[model samples]
Target chain A: MHLSPMPSAIVATELSKTYDVKVRDPGIKGALAALARPRYRQVRAVDNVSFSIERGDAVAFLGPNGAGKTTTLKMLTGLLFPTAGKAQVAGYDPWSGGNPFRQRIAFVLGNKQQLLWDLPPEETFRLNRAIYGVSLADYTTRRAELVELLLLGDLIDKPVRQLSLGERMKCELAAALLHQPEVLFLDEPTLGLDLEAQQTIRTFLGEYRRRHGATILLTSHYMADVTALASRVLIINRGRLLYDGELSELVARIAPIKRIELVLSETVSRARLEEYGTVAHYAPPRATLEVPRETATAASTRLLTDLDVADLSIQDPPIEEVIRIAFGETEQDAEEDTVRTDVQRAPP
Target chain B: MTRFTRAMIVLRAFWQLNWLEELQYRGNFVASLLGTIFWLVMAMLTVSLFFRHTPQLGGWGYWDVVVLLGIFNALAGVVETVLRPGIGHLPTDVRSGALDLVLVRPVDAQFYVSFRRLDVWRLADVMLGLAVSGYAFVQTGRAISAWELLAFAVTFAVAIAVVYAIWVTLMSLAFWFVAVENMAALFDAVFEAARYPVSAYPGALRFLFVYLIPIAWTTTIPASALTGRLNPALATWAAAVGVAALGASRVLWRVALKRYTSAGG
Candidate 1:
C-alpha cells in the first residue's frame, strides 16, 4: 500500500476526543446504585481541532484549564486515540505509525515524570538512548551538549527525588531531547516554576528550536512562556478551537485597548481620571486607565502633563486577559449551537 | 535488526538500571532473605504435620509432595522477582496515566511493562527452591536419567511461561476496571492452593485448579517430571497448555490496551 506524503511537520484534520467518564451521584446511596448498574457520561474534551504547524516554527497552544490543550497534545503524540478525525506527525498517522513514528517525535508533560525516581536522571538518559537505539558515540556527544545547555552539572547524577522541582524539570527536558526528535509536543512545560526557573526554560527552548529547527507545539498557563518563545498562538475553549493566528495579531484583535498606570503625588477624583481615558481603577494615590492602542503613547504622555503624577507606565494588556476575552466572546457566539453533555468527574 | 533484538536491547538497558537501583537498597536483600526462610520453614513444618497423620497424600509419597512444594516455591519466585514488580505495577500505572510514557516509546509496550523491573534479591528464592527439589529427589532414591533431566528442564520453562501468562491476564484487567487496584492480591490468594498437589484437593477444587485457574499445571507437571510420575504424553500436553496460555493472554492484553483512556492527560 502506497500513500501521498505530507510536507508539513504536523497536520491534524478535524481531530476530536471524547471520554466516557463514569458518573455517580454523591453519597453512600449513589455508591451502591453505581456498583449495581454503572452509568457513563460522554465528555468531548477536544472538538474538531484542525491546524497544521510548519517545521522550524514555535507555536503556543493557549487555553484555560480543561480547554482541550492537553488533550490535543496527547492525541498528536499518539498517547490517546482520537474519538474522530485524523492526525499526522512527521508524515505518518501518529496512532498507527509504530516505532519509526515514535522515533521521530518526543513529548514532555510537566505534570508527569518519566525518569526513574530511585535512580539518577543520567540512568534514565542511558535507558532512553538504548531504547531509541542511539549509538554510544552520539549519546555521549548529545549528553554533554544537553547537560551544558540545561546547566545540569551534577544534577543528573543525583537521584531524581532528591533534586528540587526546577532541577528535576531541567533533567526531564534533557532526557526527552536525547534523541533529537524532529517534532516536540510540550504540555505546560513551565507550570508551577519560579520566575527564574521559568525564564531559564523559556530561554533554553528558544535556543534549542533555533539550533535544531524542530517543530514545537507547546501549551503553557504562564503567559511569560508564550510571549518569550512562541510567534504563533492557538486558542481553544470548551473543546473547540476559537482562534489561530500570529501571536501579535491575536493580542491586537482580542484586546484593542492598552493599560496605562498612574501614580499621583496626592489624591485624585474619579471624574478627573476619566477625562484622560476610561478609568479602570481609581484610588487615593494610584489609578489605571484604558486607552486605545493607537493612542496609548499620547495618552500616557498627556497623563503625566495633565495630572500631578509621580510616575506613569504604559503596557499592553496581559496575554492571559487577551485569551480570556477571546474565550469568553467566542464561547458566547458558539454557545447556542453547541450541546453540553459533560459533567465533572474526579479523574480515575 | 529484528524487533526481538530491539526488545532485547531495551531489556538489557532496563535491567542494568534496575540492578543499579536495587544495589542502593541492600537492606531489602537481608529482609527479603529472612522472609523467604521464614516462609520456607513454615511450609516444611506444615508438610511434616500432614505426613505424621498419613504416609502418603493423594496416593503420593511424602518426598513427592515436597518436590511439588519446591516447584511451587520456584514459580512463586518468578512471580516475585519479575512479574510482581513488573506487570504487577500495571494497575497503578493505568490509574495514574503513567502508561502514557510506556506507550510513547518505540519498543513494544507489553514487553516494556512486563519486564521493566526485577527484584534481584528474590531470585534467591528460585535457587533455594531448586536446592530443596534436588534434596528431596535424593531422599526419594530415584535414579535420574538424561531423559528425565531434559524433561524437567523443558517443563520447568513451561511452568514459568504459564505463570507469566497468568500475571499478564490478571494485570490486563486493570485497563477495564481502573478502580480495582489490587488485582494481584486475588492471584496471591488463589496461588496459595498450588502449594499442595491438585489430587490432594477435592474433585471440584482439583478441577478448578487444573482447568479454570491452571495453577495445577504450573507446579505439578514439573515436579512430576523429576519424581518419575510424568508420562511423555502428559509432558507434551503441559507444553501445549503453556503455549495456549501465552497466546490467549497476549490477545487479552491487546484488547485491554484499547480500553486505556489515559487518565489525567
Candidate 2:
C-alpha cells in the first residue's frame, strides 16, 4: 500500500494574534484621563493554536461567544496578522496579497454585508463576474442554476435592502458562490435567519459541495448547520483548540451512555430502576433512565420483559448538552487557575 | 491580464452598477440640479457684495474671484461625486468591519477603495461649475489662447490631484483615531478657504493655506490658469506642490493602515 501526501486546503502552525486593547473606565474623568495618558492592556485574542484542513472538507468551527473563533477566522483569511505562526491556504501565503490565492477563495461575513446596499443583487452578481473574470457563458449558467436552487426569481432584481433577512441571505449565499471559489470562509452564513431559511441554506450548501467540491469552513451558532453540513468540528475556547475530531467522535468522547426514557403503566420505584443502571430521574408514571452505550439494547429488552411499560424509547444525549458539559468542565478548570493566579498577585 | 488592465475592468463594472442603481432614483437628478443652481446663485450674490466695496481685494477683480469660486464648486463636485461616496465611507467601513470584504478581493485595496462608487447626479455640479467659469471668463474680456487652454487643463488636473490627496489624508486618519467618523467635516471646513484666492487672506493665514493645508492649490491655481494670471514660474511650483501633496498623503495612508485592527466581527 502507498500513502499520499495530505492534500490540505488550509495548514496553520502555532498561529496566534494578540491585541493592544485600550482599557477605559466608565466616567467623564476616565475619558479625559484617557485623552491625557490612556491605559493600555493586552488581550490574547488567539493564543498558540495549530490545525490543518483537507481539501473539499467542510469543518465547523465551534466556540462560545468571544472564544476567539472570529479572531482565528480573521487570521486565516489574512484580515489580521498573527502575532506568531505561519498559515498557508491553497499553496500561498494569504497575507501576502497574492491575487491568485485571493481569487480562489471567498468570504461571506453574516454581520458585515458585501452586496451593494442600494443596488439589485443581479448588479452585484455582474460586478463580481467582472472582478473575478468569470466568462459570460459560465456566469449565466451558474446564475441560472443558483437562482433555481435557491428559489430566487425576481428577488435577485430587487434592491438588496428591500428584501427580508432570509431573502437577502439567499442572495448573499448566491453572490459568494458566483465566483465559484475553491475555498469558502463562511462566518455564520445562516445567522439571524428563520428555521426554514436555515434549512434551505444548509441544503444548498450540502448540494453545492457535492457539485463543486469546494472546501467550506463555517462558523454558525445553529447546530442544524453544523450537524447537516460538516462531518468534522473544531472546538476552541479561551484562545485554544480544545478538540479537533469527527462530530460523532466528539459526541462519543463526551457522552458514553445513552439516555433511556421509560413511560410506565404503573408506578416504578427508584430502587427498581437502579437494578438496571443509574436513574437520571424517577417519577410516579415516568422514569428517565441512563444505560451504558453498548448495553442499551440488552437493558431495554430486560426492562420490557421485567416491567409493565407503556412506552420505552432510547436516544443519545443531544449534542448541545454534550457541548455544554464539555465547555463547563473546561471553564471550571480555567476558573480555578484564575483564582490561583489572583491569589499570587494579591500580596504583590 | 496585467494588474492595471484588470483594475480598469473592475472600475468599468463599478460605473455600470452605479448607473443602474442611480436610475432607480430618477427624481434626484432634477433635485440635485436645482440645488446646485440655487447654491450658485447664493455664491454670486456673496461675490457681488464683496465687489460692492473693494475694486480688487488681494489684486483680483470681481470676475477673477468668480473664477476661483467656480473652480471651488468644481473641486467640490469632485469631492461629492467620487471621494465622498467612496473613500469617505472608509471610517464607517473600518468601524463596521466592512473593509474585510475589500481586503480579500483580488483588486488593489487602495485603488478599489478610492473609486468603488460614484454619485452620478452630483456630477452635474462639475458641468455647472465649468459653465460658470466659462461665463466668468467672458466677463474678464481677455483673449483666451490655446496655450491658456492647455495650461487650464494641467492646472485643473493638479487641482483634482491635490483635492484627492487632501481627502486621502483626512480619511486615512480614521484608522488611527477610530472615533473620527465625521473627519471629512474638517476638509469641508478648510475647503471653504479655497473659494477665494489665497492672497485674499492675511499674510500668515495665506501662508497657512498655501503650505500647511495646501487648499490654495485646489482652487487658486486652476482659476488663475483660466484667467491668464498664473505666471510660468508659479505654474511650475503648483505642479510640484501637487506631486508633493499626493506623496505625503500616500505615506500617511500606509502608516495609518498599520493601526487598523478592524472593528466588529
lDDT of 1 at A94: 89
By summed lDDT, which 10 consecutive residues of candidate 1 chain A come out lowest?
A337-346
True contacts kept of each: 0.81, 0.79
Instruction: State interface RMSD in Å for all models.
Output: 1.0, 1.2
What is the CAPRI rating of model 1's predicted complex? medium
lDDT of each: 0.87, 0.84
Q: How far in Å is the alpha carbon of A139 misplaced in model 2?
A: 1.1
What is the overall TM-score of model 1 with all chains considered together? 0.90
* DockQ of each two-chain model: 0.68, 0.63
In candidate 1 the C-alpha lDDT for residue B204 amounts to 97
State the lDDT of candidate 2 residue by residue for A239-305, as single tens digits: 8888888988876676677878999997778998999988977886888887878999999999999
